[model samples]
Target: MRSIAKPATQHTITANAKVVDQLPFQDRQAYADARQGFIGTIDPLVITDDSGRVVWDLEQYAFLQDESPTTVNPSLWRISQLHMAHGLFKVTDRIHQIRGFDISNMTVIEGESGYIIVDPLTSVECARAAIELVYDHLGERPIRAIIYTHSHADHFGGVKALIDEDDIHPGGVRVVAPSGFMEHTVSENVYAGNAMYRRAQYMYGQNLSVDPTGMVSTGLGIALSQGQISLIEPTDLISDSGQELVLDGVRIEFQFTPDSEAPAEMHFYIPEMRALCMAENVSHHMHNLYTPRGAQIRDAAAWSRYIDEAMRRYGHKSDVMFICHQWPVWGTDSIRDFLTEQRDLYRYIHDETLRLAAHGHTMVEIAEMIEFPEGLATTWTARGYYGSLNHNAKAVYQRYLGFFDGNPANLHPHPPVESARRYVDFMGGAEVILAKARRSFDDGDYRWVAQVVNHVVFADPDNTSARELQADALEQLGYQAESAPWRNFYLTGAQDLREGVRTDEATLGTSDVLSAMTTDMLFDYLAIRLNGPKASGRNFTVLVHVTDTGETRLAELIHGVLICTPVDGHADADTSVRLDKPTLTGLALGAATLTDAVSAGAVDLSGDDELVYDLFTLFDTFSRSFDIVTP
Candidate 1:
C-alpha cells in the first residue's frame, strides 16, 4: 500500500477554520471537568513491552499542543487536546482512572485486599502499562477481580495482560461480564471479520498520520494502541437487572443491556462508592448506532430505554458517573442531566425517524428531514463526535425497515460500476461531468460534486483529473464534518483516491482470537467460506477427529449447503482427518494446506485423499484489501 500524501487544499482550510468562529468557545467546562482529579503522569508517556518495543506512545500527537490549524476542525481539535491528558487521576476517594494509556480508559477501584480492574484497554501491552502506572503510583496491589463492561474488542482484548490465565484457573480470580459476552465477541469479529476489519481501516483512520490534516482523534480517544489482543472467558455472567455481586468488599449491581452499543453489554453500579459505571452506553459524545466499520444495526429504542432505566434505578443515588471512554461526571445533578439528555438524543432520533418513515419518506429523506430538538441539541454531550444524527437516523430506518426505501426504482438498482457507466454515458462524457462538477465545487456545493465525481471515477478510475477533483471535494466535506468518523472516512477516501487503496495484511489472523475459537465456531466460520455454486450437486461427508481433545464431528456437504453434526464416530464417512485444534485452525486460515499438514505428520488422513482435497477446494478465500471507493 502506498503512503498517504494528500494534504488539505485551500478550500478545505478556509471552510474548516471558519467553523472555529461559529462554535461556542465559552464552553470550557469539559476541560475543567477532565482535569479535576489529576495526580501525575508518566513523563513523555511512552510505554514499551518486555522486549523494549514501543507499544503505546503519545509523542506522535505532540502537535496537538498547538492551536487548531486551518486544516482541522476546531471542536474536534479541542477534544483531542482533552484526550491528550494522561496518567493516574483520582475519580473519587476509592476510584482511580488511568486515561490516555489506550483508546479506552482503565478504571481501578480500591478493594478490601487489592484492586478490581474494569474494562482493560485494547491490547495486552497497553493494559499492562496501564496497571503498571496504577501500581507505580498507588503501590503494588494484587488484582482480585476483573470486569468487562461490554463485548467490544477494546474492553476485553487485554485480559491476559493484567492477570494470568493461571490466576483465573479454578476461580482464583473473579471475571464478571454480561451473558453471551464470549459468543458475541467472537462471532461479531470472526464471521464477517475480514470485511469489517477492512472497513475499520477507514472508520478509525489507522492509515492516516497523527497530524492536523491527518488523524486528530477518533472522538472516543486519540487512537487504538498497536499490541497483542487476548481474551479470557468470563467466570460469572450478569444475566438480569438487580443481579448483584460482592467482590473484595465492593458491591456491584448489574443492569443488563444487550443489543445496545454492542450485542452483549451491561452497566453496573457500586453501592459503597455511590458510583455508576455506565459502560459504553453513555460516553462523552453521541455513540454509534450503526458504526461505519459495519456491524448489525443497534436498536435505538432499546438503547434509549436502557439509559432511562439506568437513570431511574441509580441516577439519584450516584454521586459520580464514569464510563469506558472519556472523563467522569461528578455530582448527582450533573450526572442526571447528562443521562437524561443522552437518553433523549437517541429517543428523538428513533421516534422522529419512524414518524417520517410512516409518512412514506425514504431513509435518505428521513435522515435529512429529522433534526435534534433545541433542548437536546444545545447540550455538548449530545453533539455528534462519534455518531452523527445523519447516519443514526438512517440506522433507525434500517432497523425497522431495511435498506429498501420501498421504492421500486431502488429495489434492483445497478451496481456502482454499471450505474456509473450508464450515468457518465447519459451525461455526455467524463469531460462534461468534470465541467459541471467544477462549477458545483466553486459554488461550495461539495456534496453534489462528490456524488457526481464518484460516477466519473467509477466509470474511469484512471482519470487523474476526475480523481483529483473528487479528492478535493471530499477534503472540503471532511473539513466541515463534526463527527470524527465522518471526517476520517471522507479524508481517507480522498487520500486513497489520490494514492491507492491500502494493501496491508489483515491483523485478525495474528491475534489471540483464533486460539479462543471453539471447534463449533471454527466450523461455522468454515461454513461461511463454503462456495455454494462450486458445491452444487456434490455430496460428501467428512468426519473430523481431534486427537488432543477426543472430539469428533461430521461435516456434510449436500445440495450447496454444509451441515455440521457432533457424533461419536461416522462409520460410512467419505473422508476422515484426525488433527488437533491448532492444525485445524491453520487449515481453516489457509496458513497450512491439507497436503502440507499430512506431509508434516500433523494430520492423519483416512477414507479417500481425493475427497478430502475436493472438500478443501470447495472453500473460497476472501481478500482483506478489497476496493471500497473505485469499482
Candidate 2:
C-alpha cells in the first residue's frame, strides 16, 4: 500500500492516457512476421472460476506506460514490452497455457481423472485465472496432480486455488517436487524473507510502475507477483539425478538438478509421449549469474554438468521439449540445438572466467572483461533473461575461489559510502565530479553516468540533485538493458536514489518471517545473521519446548550468542520457553517482544529472562547490501 516517495519530477501520470515523447518505434511488421513464425504467438483469453467473479484481468496488461521513463534501461524496456504482451497461449493438444503468467508459463497437463498442473504461477488468484482460461477453451478438468519442478514460489504458489485442504490425501491428488523441497522452499524465503523480498522489489522492479520509461522486464520475464504467496508440500520428492515416477497415470522420469536455479530443482521426461518437460532448467532466455534477490551463490560448474546430463539422458529420446515458460522446441533437432546452446553458454562462462581468474583478474575485473563468445551469443535463447553472463562468470569464480583475490591490500577495506566521500574529496570538489557526470550523461553512456554518480548519491543520500541525476541516469540504463532483472535493478536503484529506501510495511517484514520459522531453520538463519563481533564473549543456554508440537531443542548462547545444540525431545535443561508456532511467529514479527510476550503470558519462561535476553543478544541482524555487485 505504501508507495515509495520519489523526488518531485515534471513527469506526471494521469488517469487518462498519457502523452510523452515515444522512443524509437519497433517495427510492427517485423514483430507480426515473428508472430507468424511462432505458431501460437497471440495468447487466447480464457478467464475462469470467478463464476462471474471479476478477480483479475490480464487484458489491462496488454498495454503499459512507463513511470520512471528516464531511469530504466532500454534492453529491459524491449523485454518489458514483450512481457506486457504476454497472454494465454496454447502449448499443445490437450494442454493449454497462460503464457507469461507470473513471469513464467503455467502448463495445464490433461490427465484421465483431472488436470496435472506444472508450476502453478505465483498465487492462487493468478493460477485460478490461468486454470479458468484452460477450462474455458479445452473443457473443464479437475486437478489430479501438481508437479513442482523446483522450489521457487512462482512455480508452485497457486496450489491452493487449484486444490484445497482436501487435496493432500491418499485418494487426493499427489503433489510432486524435489527432495528437501518443502524444507528448502520454506527455509529459503523464511529465514531472510523480509530483506530479500524488499531487495527483490528492487531486483525485480516490483513497485516501479509500468510505462515506456518507468519499469520494464526482469531479464527473466515480467515483474514478480506482488500478490499473496502459497506453497504446496510435494507429495513426491525426486532425489536422484535419474528417477522415474508415475503421477496420475503420467509416466514421468525426473532428473534432479540442484544448485543451479534454486537449491532444490529438477527436470523430467514423459517417456511414453516422447515429450520432455525442461521445467525451468532450460528456458528460451539466459538464467541469472547471481540473482539480484539475496541467496547463496549458485554453482555454475554444477549447472553446466546437470544441463549436459539432461541432454544426454532426454534430448535424443524426446520429440518435443516444452519448457515451463516461453514456448516449446518441437522436434529432436530443435530441442538438441536449444540444449547445446544453453549448455555451452554456462560452460563458456565457467571455463573462461576460470582462465581469466587464473591470469589474476579480480571478480569485478572478470565480470567487466568476460563476454559470452559466439558459440553462446549467436543463440538468442542464451541471451540474459534470468541469468546474465556478467554475474554468472563472477559467481563461478566466487564458487571456486573465495571473495579475496589473494591480495592483502583488498583484505579489509572501508565501506563504500565512507570511501566514496574520501575519493571525491581527493578528486577536488563535488562540482568537478558533477561536470564529468554531465559529460557522460550527454554521451548517452548511461553505465558510465551511473558509475560516476554513485560517488555523490552514496556520499550524500540527501543530495536532491545527485539523486535526481542518478535516478535519471539509471532510468536510461534500464531502458537499454536486455535483461529484465538488470533493468529492474537499475530502475530500482534509481528509484531508491530519488525516493529513498522503501521498506515494504504492507508486505511481511523480517521479524514476521522469523516467527514462522521452524526450530531447525530459525537456528540456521539466526546463525547466519548473528553478528559475531557483538557476541564477543557472553555465554548462556536455554531449552525450548514447543507446547503444541512437543518439539524440544537446546539453544546455547556462547561467546555472547545463541547456537543450536543437541536437544532431544527428552533432554533436560535450565529454562524452557513454552509457546505455539503462531505465538513464536507473533514474537518474531515484533508484535510482541520478549518482555511483552512473557508479560502477556503467551511465553512460559522457567529460568532467568536475563539469560534469554543474553541469548537473544547473540543473534545478529543481516545487512541488506553486502556488496555483491561492485565493491
Best by TM-score: 1
RMSD of 2: 5.8
Tell me the lDDT of candidate 2.
0.68
List ranges where model 2 is wrong by over 4 Å. 1-61, 64-78, 84-88, 506-517, 526-538, 569-572, 589-592, 595-601, 609-631
**Minimal lDDT window, size 10, model 2:** 11-20
Task: Tell me the TM-score of model 2.
Answer: 0.85
Candidate 2 structure quality by residue, lDDT tens digits, 1-631 = 2334342222222201121232223333313311322223224432333354533344545444443343343334444555554555555555555665567778777777788888988767778766766676667877889899888878887778788757789978898898877777778886677578667877776667765555545656565554455665667789997688777787788898888777999888887778888787777668865786778888777787888888899889988777776667777887888888888877788899999998999998999998776566535577675678788877888888978888898899778888879877876757788888887776666677788778876776666667677777776655555567776777777666655665444423433223435766655655665677776775666787777867777877666455677466655556667877666655444444677777878888877767776655555444444332222
How do the predictions measure up, each by TM-score? 0.97, 0.85
Window of ten residues with lowest summed lDDT in model 1: 1-10
lDDT (tens digit, per residue) of candidate 1 on 200-224: 8888888887687778889889989
C-alpha lDDT of all candidate models, in order = 0.87, 0.68
Which candidate gets the maximum lDDT versus the true structure? 1
